[model samples]
Target: AQSVTQLDSQVPVFEEAPVELRCNYSSSVSVYLFWYVQYPNQGLQLLLKYLSGSTLVKGINGFEAEFNKSQTSFHLRKPSVHISDTAEYFCAVKGDTGNQFYFGTGTSLTVIP
Candidate 1:
């Protein structure tokens, strides 16, 4: 089984400022890491994935995350943000087969201008 923990439930920031959303996971086997963003009353969209190779992975909306095996963390970060970036973010883990997905409760990013 796999599980994810998002350290913060809400993060507020100013427009064009930097932001980071923390995430941690535990699994018995190799898995895929993903970050999804959900807009108001909308479905989640894939931000990025760490399938293999580099530990640092980039995604949409100027967001990026680095996979840390030792710490079991995949923290999302962006140097600058926009008010439009205001939304909910979720961190998820999928097994090798990439079938079932386990997600964190969610982190709401409120970008104020």
Candidate 2:
């Protein structure tokens, strides 16, 4: 079994400032990690994933995260955020075979202009 935990339910920031959103997960077996972004009343879009090789992964829109094995965490970070970055972020994990995924409650990123 696998589960994801998002530390923050919301993160408010000003435009063009750095931001970090915390995410953690637990699984019985090896799992794939992903970060998805969702705009208001829109579908989720894949931001990034950590499959095997690199611990540090970069995604679209200047976002990045690091996979920490010992800590069992993958935290998303962006140096500078925009008002357009305001959205809900979800951290997800998937098992080896099944496509079924476990997602975090969600983090609402409100970027102030």
Judged by lDDT, which candidate is best? Answer: 2
- Candidate 1: regions farther than 4 A off: none
Per-candidate alpha-carbon RMSD to the true structure: 1.2, 1.0
How badly does each model clash, as a count of residue pairs? 0, 0
lDDT digits (tens) for residues 1-113 of candidate 2: 78899999989999999999999999757889999999999999999999999899999999999999888899999999999999999999998988899999999999999
Model 2 vs truth, CA RMSD: 1.0
lDDT of 1 by residue, 20-99 (tens): 99999997467789999999999999999999899999998799999998889999999999999999999999889758
Considering summed lDDT, which 10 consecutive residues are worst modelled in model 2? 23-32
Error of 1 at 67 (Å): 0.4
